[model samples]
Each structure stands twice: as C-alpha cells, then as structure tokens.
Target chain A: MEFDLIERIRRHTEVNRDDVVEGIGDDAAIVAVPSGRELAIAVDTLVEGVHFPAGTAPADIGWKALAVNLSDLAAMGATPAWALLALTTPDGDEAFFDGLARGFAELATPYRLALVGGDTTRGPLTVTVAVHGFTAPGEALLRSGARVGDVVMVTGTLGDAAAGLRCLAEPDASAYAALVERLNRPTPRVSAGQALRGIATACIDVSDGLVADLGHICAASGVGADIDAEMLPRSSALLTHFADADALDFALAGGDDYELCFTVPADRAGEVGATLARLGCGAARVGRIVEDAGVRVFDARGNLYEPARAGWNHFAA
Target chain B: MEFDLIERIRRHTEVNRDDVVEGIGDDAAIVAVPSGRELAIAVDTLVEGVHFPAGTAPADIGWKALAVNLSDLAAMGATPAWALLALTTPDGDEAFFDGLARGFAELATPYRLALVGGDTTRGPLTVTVAVHGFTAPGEALLRSGARVGDVVMVTGTLGDAAAGLRCLAEPDASAYAALVERLNRPTPRVSAGQALRGIATACIDVSDGLVADLGHICAASGVGADIDAEMLPRSSALLTHFADADALDFALAGGDDYELCFTVPADRAGEVGATLARLGCGAARVGRIVEDAGVRVFDARGNLYEPARAGWNHFAA
Candidate 1:
C-alpha cells in the first residue's frame, strides 16, 4: 500500500539529473558530489502540532518541512541539490500525499533539487527532511568566523511569519492573508545565501528568535552584538497590521521566519547590501559585532530592550 | 533545554576526521566527500509502537536505529562514513539520552562515522537516521543487475529475529537470549558487502524477510526466482526453539532479520559461498533466478509451497 503512495510521489517529483546515478527504488541512493566541493548537509523534523499548528494544510506542512532544512543550507552558503524526506502519517489517504507531494515539488522544481530517497512509516504526522548541497572548500559561511569589528545584517524583512501565525486566530484572517502565507510558505534565501559565500563572515538562519540566534553566533565566535530596534526592517503589511512596539516584539523575539542573519566586515557591509539588493531579496544593516560576550538590544530611546519571550525552545515548559 | 541535550549528544559522538570540516552544533554540517568516489545515501524512520513494541529499552532503540541505516549502506556495497540523526521524544530525561548515546556510540565508534548534524524536537518517540557512505564509481551493487540463471544466496541465518520477537513474550525468554539479541542488535554486514562489490550480481539486506526482499531484486531485474524450502539456512537457536514448520514460516515470511540476500553467477556460486565463509558469515545457496516474473517456492516433495503471510508493508491494513 505504501509502495503505491511512493509511486505517486515519484510521478510528481520525477527529475532527470546527471549527478544522480540511482534514485528512489534502490537500497540506497547513489549520487556523485561535484568535484572539489565540500558537501553541506542538514536535517530537520517538523511535528504536527509543535512545528506547525494542528489542522494546518498538508501542502503547507510539506513546503515548510523542506523550507526549514533549505534554510539551514542557505545559512551555510550552499546550493541545494538533493533531499530525502521521511514522512510519518496517521492515515493512508492518497489526497494527503497528493497535496504533500505537489507542495514539495513546487518548491523543489525552482531549485532543481531532486528528492533522492526516503521512507514512509506509520506514526504521528512528522516530517523529517535531510538536504545535501555543495559549497566550495573553505567558502562555507561559519558561525564562528565573525570578528568583533564585523557588521550584523539580515536578508529580507523579519517578524512576518511570527505575525502570520498570530493572524491565523484573528476574526478577520482574510485581511492578513499575506502574513498567514508567510508563515505557511517561507521563501528560503537560497540564492541570496550563495551570493554571500565569499563576503559574509558569519551566517545563520533565524529559526529561533533574532536575539537567541544572534546569541549563538556571539557564543561561537567569542564576541558580542548590539542591535538597534528602530533599524529592523518591517514589511508594510506587518506595520499596517500592528502597532510599532508589537511589530518590534515579533521581529526581535518571535521565531519561525526563515531569514538569513549574517555578518560582514564593517567596510564590506555596503557592498553586501548592494549585492543582495540586485538579487532583489534586499538586506538590512541591523547591528554591529562588539567586544562583549552576549547579544544586546536597544530601543530608539537608547534603553535596553526586553521582549515578552526570549526564544523558541522545544523542551522548555 | 534542547540545545543542552544536543550538547550531551555532541560530547558522546565527537569524532575528528580530515574529511569533516565541521560537526554538530553548526547550522549545517560541512563534510568533504572523498574525491573520485560516489556517495550512497539512505534514510529510515522507526516509530515507537509501530516499528518496535512499546516498553523497549532506550539503548536498544538507539542501537537498532543506527543499525538499520548501516544495513542499507551494507546493501549498497558502500563504506559508511557520516550520519545525521533526528530524534523526537515525549520527555527530556538525562538517563534516556545517556543510554541512547552510549548504544549509538558503541556501534558508531568502529565505523568512525561522524555524527554531523541533526535536530531534536518534542513529539511522539521517533528516530530518523540518514546515513552517507562512499563507493567507487560503477561499483555499487544495484537491484537491477541480477540476471537469469544466477544463484540466489543469503548471508548468515534467517528466522532468528522473527523467532526472537516471539521469544520476547515467552515465559522462558531468558532461555532465548541469543534470539532476542538478534532482534535487538543485529549486526550490519558492512565488510561482507564491500567484499562482494565486484563479485555479486545484485544485493539487498533482508529487513523484510528472505522471500520479500529477494522479490525486490527479482522485480527490479525482471526475473523470477525458485527457492527450495528445505535448503533455507536455519540457526541452532531457531531450530531448537520451534518445530520445523514454524521455523520455516519465520525463515520465509517473518521480518526484521538484517541478513543479506544476494545473487551471483551460477558458475561461481560455490566460490561465493566459500568467500563468505572466510568472513565468518556463511552464505547458503537456496534458490536460483528463473525466466518467470514472480517468486515460487518448492517443498521437499516438489510440491508448490505456501506461507501463512507475505512480505511486510508499512501501510497494510
């Protein structure tokens, strides 16, 4: 029965790539990694209620599952090439698979990434995707490479997905369609990340809140960071839907926006912004790396800012 | 809290290799795929109560999770190198992580497979492992390579794990220690697979019983097979614990045994058996590929044989 479902997935996701020697049907997949390139690999799991709210559409779940993993590759400045998806479903309804496969293929086609191999099992609705990409040796952006003098930057606007999640429960959700779509279908900054390969000193994707993820870079690089709250870029939709302080809270401490948070040398910050601008994704110069050892946020009045929640922690009560 | 758990996992699974540019704690792992070698990748998921029964030991779950993935590598005739693990749990218990890590490291240390990167989430207990291995170009043992007039063979003995599952609930479970261990910690035939790369026509690991797994090779190769039921290999432990008919049922249709079902040219069947004998995992010649399109079985008196069940399907009602 699962074999038939796999056949439908294959039909929707079929791609002929020269690098793939063998795919889906074999004991394992065989692929020739591009010569002289280091492979960037990442895996992430999304549970039904934890990663996405229950009753969410299966297509959205499929998109977000692959998006989150691709975001990790983007954070490493790699180009995605292959992915393996392990999906656990509670029922065998083919409509669910059709929607899920269509959603996965929709994102996969633009990147030309092949769904190489994976297994389906009977369990809670969980999706785990392992992605493989290639980066030139010594060119992958690392979390530990940021220096004290570097400038902090981020690709695309923040707080949109966080705001999108909140909009789902609103009585007038149709008015916030864009925000809900942001939460459902995040645009992984794939091309923008590859553009920053040689220029960015340190990089990470914002799955956790901005303050928490930036704190990771600080801890890894033995440095610190200071972000000006007023400098954070906000989407027009976010600004129109919420008050300034609320938007700032979502941007600073809310999670699930798959945006790239990176740093470049202080002098090259302008060049990095220009490069991303032409790519049309755009980036904002939000903060600066400091000599201290933690992430510090300040408001327009120059007072230390505080958020209602620090960050997303899976095991936190 | 999850990061702390990941930190503990990192400490238990830390291994340094030149090919690994970065390990755990990165947004994504950076590993240099060996030059001139193709990569063999596979991912499998095991859900609590579905894959393994409830109340199984945490250590056993960890061991089986990695072991099953390694078995897939062994089937592809690849040398294991790196793995990514995504684990979901209902609670955060230090003892559970300790036992699980120890069991994983006990098997991983020998292969030197570096745990590169993965994520932890809160959900029902599910463990998904994606393993990467290396094989020389054009040397992987594929399912479509078997031909008519080839000898069908299997490594080690069959029926042990199937019988072991039954033994777990028996009052004399301790008397069947070897059988239960086979179910819990089946050895992955890594070295044996590599040794058969240039020799075996086709290969697959028997996670889904001998007849079912061999059926995959036949389907892919466009051939049929005829198995002599009397010639199927049986372990002393399996034979002692059950009558002949029961043992035969387990050998033909029961699942979970991590044995290798392979095909070789009929002319070299004896030589292949001798080779595996030297590897301390003896091979039994029990069947042959034929011109028809589905598997057939013959009893001692030459009558067609039937088993109580067919192969396993994850979504079978």
Candidate 2:
C-alpha cells in the first residue's frame, strides 16, 4: 500500500533533469550542483490544526505546505530546484493522497521542482517539506546585512491572509474570494528576491507578521526600524473586507502573510523599486532603518502605534 | 518559548565548518559544495506509536530518528555532512528536549554533521530528519547496478534489533543489554559504506526485512536473488534469546537493522569482505544474484522457504 502511494506521488511529480542522477526509489536522492553554485536548503513543518484550521481541504494543505518552504528559499534569493516531503496521515486515505499529489504538482510544475525523496508514516496529519535550491556563490541574501540608513520595503499587500482567517471563523462574514485565495495559496516572491540579490541589503519573508519579522532583521543587523503605519500597502480586498483599525492590527500582528520584507540603501531605493516593478511585484516603502534598538511605528498623525501581540508563536498556547 | 528551545538545541549541537556559509537561525542554510562533489539528500519520519513503542525514552527516539537518515546516506557511499530536524511534540517539555538533543548530538558529533536548519511545531510526537551528504561525482553506490553474477552480502549481524524489540515486550524476557541497545540506537555503517564505494556493485541500507529490501535491488537491476537460509548471520545475543527457527525468522524477516546489504562481483567478493573487515564491520555472504525476477530462500534441506510477512508496513494495521 505504501509503495502504491509512493508510485502515485512519483507519477504526479515526474521531473526530468540531467543533473538529477537519481530521484525517488533509491535510499537517497543524488543531484549535482554546478561548480559556482551553493546549495540553499530550508525545512518547515505544518501541523493539522496549528498551521491550518481543522477540516481544511487536503489540496490546500498540500499547496500551502510546499508554498511556505518555497517562500523561505525565495527569502534566501535561491532558485527552486528539489523538494522532499515527509507526510503523516492518521489513515491512508487514497482520495486524500490524490488531492495532495495534484495540489503539490500544481505549485511545483512552474518551478520545475523535483520531488526527490521523502517518507510517509501513520500519525496525526502533518506535512513537512524540505526545499533545496541554488544561488551563485556569495550572492544569497541574508538578514544580517541591513544598515542603519537603509529603507524598508515590502512586496504585494499584507493583512489579507490574516483577515481571511478571521472570515473563516465567522461564516456569516462577507466572503472575500481574493483574500481567501491569498490565505490558501500565497505567491512566493521568487523572482522579486532574485532581482534584489545584489540590490537589497537584507531580506526575510513575512511569515510571522510585519512587525515581528522586521524585528528579526533589526536584531540581526544591529539596527532598528521606524515604520509609517499609514504607508503599509493593503490590497483592495483587505480594505473592502476590514475596517481601518482592524485592518491595521491584522497587517501589523496577525501574521500568515508570505510577502518579502527587505531593505535597501536609501540611495538604491528607487532602483530597487523599479526592479521589483519590472519583475511584476511592485514594492511599497513603508519604513526606514533607525539607529535605535527596536521596532517603532507611527500613524499619519505622528502618534506612536503599539500592537497587542508581536507575532505568531508556535508554543505560546 | 520556541526561541528558548531553539537556543537549547543550538547549545547542544554546535558545528564549525568553513564551507557552511550560514547555519541555523536563517530562513535557509547555505553550504558550499566543492567543484567535484555531488549532494546526496534523504529524509525519514518517525511517529510516536508507529516507529517506537509508547513511553520509550525521548533520547532513544531522538537517536533512532537521526540514525535512520544517516544510514540512508551511508548506503549511497556518501560522507555525512549536515542535517535538518523537524520535531513535533504535544507540548514543549524541557527535559524531553534536553535528552533528545543529547542523544542526537551523541551520534552526530563523530560524523561532524552540522544541525543546519529545521522547524518545530505543536502536534503529536514526530521527528522528521533530512540529511545531506557529499560524494565525489559519479561515485555514489546505487541499487540499480547489481549484475546477474554478483554475490549478495550483509554487514554486521542481523535479527538482533528485532529480537531486542521482542524482549522489550516481554517483561520476564531476560534482559539482553546488547540486543536492547541495538533496538534503540542501531549504528549506521558509515565507514563500511565509504569503504565499499568502488567495490560493491550495489548497496541498500537494510531498513525493511532483508528479503524485501533485497527485492528492491533485484527489481531495479532486473535480477533475482537466491539465499542460503542457514548462512544468515545471527548475533550471539539473538541465538541465546530465541530458538533456532525463531532466530532464523527474525534474521531473515526482522527489520530495523541499519546494516548495509550490498552486492559484489563473485570474483571480487573476497576483496570487499576484507575491506569491510578492516573497517570493523565484517561482511557475510549468504546469497547470490540470478537472472530471474524475485527473491528465493533455500533452507538447509535445499527446499524453498517463505515468511508470513515480508517487512514492516506503515499502513498495514
């Protein structure tokens, strides 16, 4: 039964690349990294209830599982290549496996990412994806390079996914299709990150809300950030579905937005913005790096803004 | 709380290598692969009840989780390099994390394997490890290379871990310290695999029963295998603990022995045997590859023998 499921997954995700000496069916997968490239690897695990709400569609879960890891690679300015999935299901449901394989393939086909290897076990539903990518030597982005005078920018809009989760809880809430799609299938800023390789001083994907993830950049680079909350980019969907105060809170602390939060020198801000625009993901400069030690936000009236929670914590509950 | 656990894990496993451009704490780990090397990657998942008995020591669970992945790399004749761990637990228990970290470090330190990057989530207990190793380009031992006239060999003694598991179930079963240790912390045959790179025609780590795993090699290589059941290697502990018939059953069909089952040319068998012996893991030849399709075992009376179950299956229950 396990072998048949593996065969089904293999058929769904058949990637043909000369560099892949061996894919699935072996004890380990072997891939050749080109001479001047370094391998960028990242792993993320999603529990049934912790990462997603209970009774979510299996296809959406599969898409989000691979999406989160791909977002990590995008933060590192790496090109997607291969993925290994460790999937745990309470029961071996054939339809669930079929849906999962289709969803995984839908997201992976565009990037040509091969499903190299993984393991399956019986337990509570959990999905762990480890993605491997490649970047030119010394060209990958890191969060520790932000400078005091750098400008903070974010791609696309924030708060949509968080608002979508809230809408999920209130069945009578006005359904915002775009926001829900954003929550289910996030667009990893792969090309945007690649375009910012030599331009951005620091980069991180906003998985743990804007304030908390930017705090990581601040701590790593030994700088602080001052954000103009009024300048935060919000999609039409988010604005239509939420009020001003609630939308601001969702954007600031609700998390689950996979947009790239990056920094560039003040002088290169225009160039970076144009580059991202050319890559089809326009950027909005919402903040600037400061010499202080922590994140600070200001409203249009210049009053300091404080959020109730910083970000998502896996073990806080 | 998550950060504190991460810090504790970081303190337990610290690796210093010039090639590791970035370690933990980043979205992705960046590692340099030398000009002539290829990366071998593998992943394995262990659930609470499926992989181990309930109430098992946390340290043992940690060790076995990593050991299984390293064994996969060993089968590919790759030197262990880095590992990513995705640990899911019902709750964050400090003592459990401490013991788990210690056990993981105990096995990783000798291989200089760096704990590069991973994720932690709240869920049922599960440990998924993705291991990365390097091998010279085209030097990997693959399962599809065994020829028709090759001799099948296995490293170390078999059936010890299976017998050890049985002993654990029976409270009155005489405590076999060595066998129990084998069941909990089976050693990965790294050195032996490295030694057989050019000598062995094919290689696979014996996670499933010997017959089932060997059947994988045969299926891949378009060959069959015939084994002399009486020549199967058995540890003194296994022989002392069970009757001859039961011990043979365990040796042939019991899983969890992280030993290398490989094939060599009939003429070069002696040289490979001596090489493994020098590496401190003596090899025993008990079978031969043939032109047919499936694995066949012959008892001392020269009659074919079959077992009720071929190997462990996650969904069988």
Candidate 3:
C-alpha cells in the first residue's frame, strides 16, 4: 500500500539535476551540499487538533504542512531547496495517503523544492516537515537585526487567515471564497523574502497573529513598536466579509497570516517598498521601532484600543 | 507544566560555546553556521501503534524517538548539535507530556544538543524528532561511498533491541533485565560516529534490523554484503531467553538496533577497531562488501541462509 502511494506521488514531480544524489525511497536522504552556502534547516509539525480543524481536507493539510515550514525559511530570507516529510496517518486507505503526498509534491515541484526523503507511519493524522534551504554564508536576516527607529513593514495583507478561520467555525455565514482560501492555502512569500536578503534589518512570518509575531521580532531585536492602525493594509475582500464590529481586531490579532513582516531602515524604506511593488506584493508602513520595549497601537485619532488577549496559544485553553 | 519540564531538562546539562547561538525559548533556534561546516538534518516519527507495541511508556517512546533520529545523523558522521521535537498526545495528562519532554531533553543535553524549537498538539501519542548536526564541509560520510572490497563492521552488539522487544512482548517471561533495557533505551553511537569522521568509507545506522538496514547501504552504494553468521554479535542474554530457532532468526531480522553499521577499507579495519575501542565501543568485523547486488549470509556450517522474503515492511503486515 505504501509502495502504491509512493508510486502515485512519484509520477507528478519532475526530478531535475543530479545534485540530489538520492531522492526519496531511502533510509535517509543523501544530497550534495554545495560548497560555500550556509544551510538553513527548520522543522514544523502540524497535528490534526492543534494546527487545523479536525477532518480538514487531506490535500489542504498536506499543503499546509509544507507551507508552514517554508514560511520559516522565508523568514530567514533563504531559498528553499529540499524537504523531508515524516507523515503519520491512520492506517486505513492507501489512496488517501497518496492524495496527501501528491498534493504536497504538486506544490513543491513549482518551487524547485525536491522531496528528498520522508517516513510514513501509522497513527493519528500528523505531518512533520523538515526543510533545507541555503543562503550566502552569514547573510540570513534574523529577528535580532531590528534597531530603534527602523520602520516596520509587512508584505501583503493580514487578518485574512484569522477571519477565514472564523468563517470555517461558522460556515453558514456568507463570506468571500477568497478569504476562506487564504485560510486554507497561504502563499509563502519566498521570492519577496529572497529579495529582502541584504536589505531588511529583521524579518519574521505572521503565523501567530500580526501583533503576537511582531512582538517576537521586537523582543528579539530589543526594540518597541508603535503601529499606526490606519496604515495597515486591508483587502476589500477582508473588510467586506468582516466590516462589522472589531473586524479590525481580527486583522490585528488574527494568526495564520503567512505574510512576511520585516523592518527596514528609514533610508531604505522607499527602495524596499519599490522592490516589493515590483514583485506584485503590497507593502504597508504599519509601524516604527522605538527605544522602549512595549508594543502600542494607535487609531487615527491617537487613542489606543485595548488589544485582545487571545492570539493563538496551542497549549492554553 | 512545559516550563517545569524545560527547567528540569535544562538543569541536566550545560550548553557549549561552539554549538549554539540561542537555545530554547524563541520563535526558532538561532544557530551560528560554523565556518567550513555543512549541516546534516534528519527527521523521524514514532507513533504508538505503529512504531511500538500498544501501551508503551511515554518515557521509552521519548527516548526511542530521539535515538532513531540521532542514529540517522550519526550515519553521516556529523556531530550532534541541536534537535526539535514535535509531540502529539491526549491533553488529559499534562504530566505525561512533561515527562516525555523531560526524557528527551535530558538525553539530548549530554550530546551537546539543545532543544531548539518544536510544536506540540493534542492527538494520539506521536513523537517526531528532527535532528541537526554539523560536519566539516564536504566531509560527511554517505552510504553510497562503500567500495566492493571494503570490510563491513558494526559497532557494539546487534539485535539487542529486537531481543528487548521479545521480552516486552512477553513481559512475564524469564528474559534478562539487561535485554529489556536494551530495547527501551538503545544508545546511539554518537562518540564512535564522531570518531569515524575521517576513517570510515561509508556508514548507516541499523534501525530496521541488520539485514534490512544493510540492504539500504547496499542499494545506495551499488554493492552487496556477505555476512557470516558465526561472527554475528549475539547476546548471551538473548540466547538464554529464546529458543535457538527464534533467537537466531530474530538476531538476523530483528529491527530497531541503533548501532552503526559501516564499511571501511580492509586495510583500515585494525585502525577503525582500535579507534572505536579507545572510545569504549565494540567494533566487530562481521562481513565484507561484495560485487553482487543482494545480501548473502552464511551459517556456522558454511551453509548460506537467505533472508525471508517479507523483511520488516512497515506498511505490510
């Protein structure tokens, strides 16, 4: 059964270049480490109950497993090259596992990310993907690079994913299909991240709501933030679906937005904005770093609204 | 509860200056890419019903998950540096999860490995560990580098894990206590693996029994092996507990032996053996690589013993 599933996944992807040495179907993968590149490795595990709603589509689940790990690499301004999947599923259907693997392979192929190794086991539905990427030695954009007075920016919009989740929880409500798709299939900003390689002072992906994830960057970089709420990028699609009370709250604290949030020096902000525009992604000058170590959000009237205590905490109720 | 567990594990070992930039408690681990080093990464997942018997202790499961992934990194002759753990368990007992994490953290600390980052979820008992190690650039040992005339050697004893499993399968039986320990905590050859840095030609860790794992090395290196039954590493503890037929068969095909099986030039055998001994490890020459494509084992009377057709296929019954 595993063999049959493996065969199905193998058919969809093109194996280019011999540098992979060995791809899949081995005890472990063997890849040629090109000389003079720093390897960036990260692993992410998404279980059925914690990372997504139970009984989510296997295809979406597979796509998300790879997407979240790729998001980590993207935060480092690294170009992803290969991945290893350790997938655990209930041992019932060979075709189901095949579908999941095929979905993963389909997304990976276009990105030139080779599925070099994986392990399949029988258990509850869980997917752990380890990604390998490369960057010029010592050139990764870290969360510690942000400085006081650096202008904080975010690529693309936020709050869409959190709103999508709310829609999923209450599916009877009418909403735009694109918002729901954003919740299910987030596009990792790989190219935009690579473009920010030398320019961005600090970077991170907005996984746990914008406010929460940016707090990580601020804490690591030892800086504070004053976000101008009115300047946040809002999609007509998101505002239309959640234009009601506290819709802005979803944008502020909604997790699962796989967009890149980074900091740029004031002098480099224009160039970075132009670069992102050329890449067809919208950029928002949402905030600026401060010498203090607290994050504050201000409305156009300069009044601060109380932030919600809920962000996505897996272990908490 | 997670905080308490992390503190307990953190107290067991100290971090070294060479292996970490930031350890634990971060968005992701920030590791320094050492000059002239290439990173080797591997991930493995263990599910309750799939990888072990039902009702296995969480502590043992924790040990095995990290051990198996460490075994993979050892195969590359890479020095262990950091690990990320993804654990899914029923949320009823926070203590259970904490115990499991403590066991993993304690085991990892002695190897100079830090718990970098991980995700936890509520689900069936599943543990996935992603290990990251570093070796001098272009110096990692590969399974595909074995030569036809090289001597195949295994560090420490084989089949201890399988023997331990037999005891676990029938706990009331009169098996020795040492065999059970072997099954529960199969120590990976970390030191021997590091020592083989410049000596061994090709290496792989024995996880899925000797025959099945050596088959992997053989397929990768485009060579075969001729193993001698008389020279096989057999535990007297196993002999005392099993019928001759079962013991020998289990010794031949039992899985989960976390020992290093590597090939070295015949002329380097003495040096490799002496080197392992200096590190307090047992290095036994058990076979020779052959030009043929399949593994062949000879019994004590010089009669050839072919492995069973169905050898340790996890997907197959």
Q: DockQ: which candidate is best?
A: 1
In model 3, what lDDT does residue B110 have? 81
Writing each residue's lDDT as its tens digit, candidate 1 over A37-94 gives: 8899999999988888888888898898999999999999999999999999988888
How does chain A of every candidate compare to the true chain A by TM-score?
A: 0.97, 0.97, 0.94
lDDT of 2 by residue, B1-317 (tens): 55467667767878787788898887899998877889999999988887777787888988999999999999999999999999999989899999888889889988998888878878899999999999997789999999998999999999888888878778664578788899889999999989989889999998877998899899989999999999898999999879998888888888889999999999998998888888888999989999999999999999999865677552241
DockQ of each: 0.93, 0.88, 0.37
In model 2, the runs with Cα more than 4 Å from the true position are A172-174, A314-317, B1-3, B172-174, B314-317
Error of 2 at B276 (Å): 1.4
True contacts kept of each: 0.97, 0.93, 0.31
Model 2, residue B75: C-alpha shift (Å)? 0.8
lDDT per residue for candidate 1 within B1-317, as digits (tens), equals: 55677778767877788999988888999998888899999998999887777777888888899999999999999999999989999888899988878788788889998888878888999999999999999999998888999999999999898888888779888999999899888899998899889999999999888888899999999999999999999999999989999999889987888889999999898988898899999899989999899899899999999976787542231
Which candidate number maximizes lDDT? 1
CA shift of B305, model 2, Å: 1.2
Candidate with the greatest TM-score versus the true structure: 1
Runs of candidate 1 with Cα error greater than 4 angstroms are: A314-317, B313-317
Model 1 chain A: lowest-lDDT 10 consecutive positions:
A308-317
DockQ of 2: 0.88
Span of ten consecutive residues with least summed lDDT in model 2 chain A = A308-317
